[model samples]
Target: MAIQRRGFIAAVGTGGAVGLAGCTGLGDDTGDSDNTGPEISGETLTLTTTTSTYDTGLLDELNAPFEDRYGVTVVTVAQGTGAALETARNGDSDVVMVHARSLEDEFMEDGFGVNRRDLMFNDFVIVGNSDDPAGVGGEEDIEAALTAIADAESEFVSRGDNSGTHTKELELWDAAGLTIEEFGEWYIDGGGGMGEILNQASMQEAYTLADRGTYLDMQDEIDLEIHVEGPVKDGPDELMNTYGIVAVNPAVHEHVNYDLAMAYIGYITSVEGQDIIESYTSAGEQLFFAEALSEDPEFQQYVPEGWGSSTDDE
Candidate 1:
């Protein structure tokens, strides 16, 4: 069920890697109606996004102004990038915001979604106890760090929910010449959000891969510290975490609101939207870079007709 809130969006960061919440702004009566409850206005738009956005409170910050200006009640179902893409594939959401490029490409190629646009980027970090049991602290190479953690059996937590971070973690492990199936007792399949897995790691005093922003936001609540911060650019691409927004193809589900979804896709890549993302910070540090503003060919994509952002009309 969607969490109903007045102008404020509720914190639905949860386990199981999937949850739906709704934020109604000025004069918004639309809710995440199961269609059993009161029928919401046609202005309601559904956004299936990643847990990173919610855990870092960036979703609330970015979506609040969108709701306020458009008077659209944004019904959000947050899940891992994989699960969120699955939601869009099942025709259960209007838009999908996630970071797994391979999965996102698969979805688009298979005709499950359209209008994919690169929005922002952040890097992944390996974090663990202050004691650095895995000896991964200050490590420059992610694969080597994972090798150390696996070799030492340093009690690691894997988001195993197949989120973007989890995907990257697995890739790193494979590159480290190890398979998750080979992981010993030190490895745990954390079937939850980033915050949940981090909490578990904190309780177990284990190590885990995490997004920089969420970890920073929850540092006080957890004992984990950044053991490694991959460069968002000028480093190996595996370390980069680029987020994208896509409109769920209505052809797959006629019930979906394609127009509103396109509107959101447009809004997120717009100059104003990019500015909002750029301004958001945690602990006095910018959490995400507005990649939409970058002319990087890899970040360029097709924006909906009449909706491409003025920031970087790529």
Candidate 2:
């Protein structure tokens, strides 16, 4: 959905990629008397989400139909994944859409969120200049490529803002047996969103880990190239990136718009929603794969991916 200016504004810092949009007027019409759920009309749903979604312009296409269907406005605050979850935990948001699972699990276990759903997915890629200064090009092994980059003392840009991409970058470093704390000047911490970090990497010709969608969306604006591929390009699974949507727990924050939040969630996970996600593309490439309509979904689709019988026993 194209973001509208009527009551729509974003907390700035998604790299100025797209302007914010919101619905103009609230919907006060009550549906049929037999409807069992809360009325979402005339409500404003506050959604805290990762910058990747905002930066790639997916929200414009994804949220428009939902807003029209419900006659509600969606106010988005795009930030790093960690910051997004924190916003929900603090009762500042009605819902969240983020990609960092570990952080999401903590939010759920702490009773700040509920109704988690596997929404959509893409993959992470290691990008750098075409020269491939660290000699990491064509390597399927993400860890090895990272190690080589470190060993060569090459410039590496980090989203150090605690975003999902930052979390994945740290995971890759750990897998490579390299503590980022030990690295020298070659490591650059870019405390910004995905689009900003990509721009930073582009200007400096440094290496950075980024979601495939954001990279492709800004490909024309930046000089950086994909030095190593993620699962989307037949690389390792460690680079697989999945995003989730969860509503803030009304039990934790009664002021939150729980009804409208659930409505938004239901709309995004429905068959029509899945199709919208599937059809969204950038740079002539599909950005995310819809996961909600799978015929054989996992139990974790409704919980954390690592949850199982043992977690339940505990």
Candidate 3:
């Protein structure tokens, strides 16, 4: 059973809040309202999203209701944020939902997508062996923690998949005035998804940056500890991870399903969809927060009550 969506916000304090499966051209498959009666079944919408959501099974939970409601099958192609965007750029997917903000911007400017919408958010956490070899445990300053890890030449694992987590890891290294190359053998690139890298890090006892949701979901099977994460309310500001969705531009890729893709964008950003995100949990812990419903300029247009500032009336 799911929790009540409104109460989820007050109860969890999630920093605030906030598919498609088709391969056809716009309106070629998932039909419009006019043809809704007889042709509503078995339409496909291909969704390309990130490891953070995919690894934790949030994608399945989130899409199940949406897929059943529309009678549309959603084929999820999961990878690091960079790869997911690349899949959309090549016009292989109908829509994208990923974390890396700068890459999302580049994707839009390069004419890959439109109707980009802020979806949801969950911060990253630094996980490591409980031994505290790097002495980074409980470090309030993420930069300092990273610097300490480098200075000690402690074993550190990187997703190295150009993922949003990897992107954030690189940014943290930059902020720490260090580089992975300089760390030499102490730093290892796992070149895999969150769960794989986390498992590798656990076996090797290395430090790594992981989305909190994924870490929590996989924690039972691993021995790693949350070495450097604070409570959501007090977590490092720089660690905040925001996820967004975009409808692949039909103009750039003429064979894309623009209409159904937009419906997906609309569905996930709507109150019901955001609520679905808020209500989802495992072991009684909510995996994500609904930032789309917040009063931010980027998301205001999508908020139902006209409560926030709308940048494009969305």
**For model 1, how does the per-residue alpha-carbon lDDT over 248-291 read when each residue is reduced to its tens digit?**
87787899987667666666666667667878888888888776
lDDT of 2 by residue, 180-275 (tens): 989999899999999999999999999999999999999999999998888877888899999999999999899998777777787677666766
lDDT of 3 by residue, 255-303 (tens): 8766667767766766667777877787788789886554434543222
In angstroms, the error of model 2 at 184 is: 0.4
Candidate 1: deviation at residue 293, Å? Answer: 2.3
Choose 2 or 3, whichever is better by lDDT.
2
Rank ordering of all candidates by lDDT, starting from the highest: 2, 3, 1
What clash pairs does model 2 have? 1-60, 1-61, 1-64, 3-21, 4-21, 4-22
Ordered by TM-score, highest first, the candidates read: 2, 3, 1
TM-score each candidate.
0.80, 0.88, 0.83
lDDT-superior candidate, 1 or 2:
2
**How far out, in Å, is residue 23 in model 1?**
23
In terms of lDDT, which candidate is strongest?
2
lDDT of each: 0.76, 0.84, 0.78
Kindly report the root-mean-square deviation of model 3 from the true structure over all alpha carbons: 7.1
TM-score (C-alpha) between model 1 and the true structure: 0.80
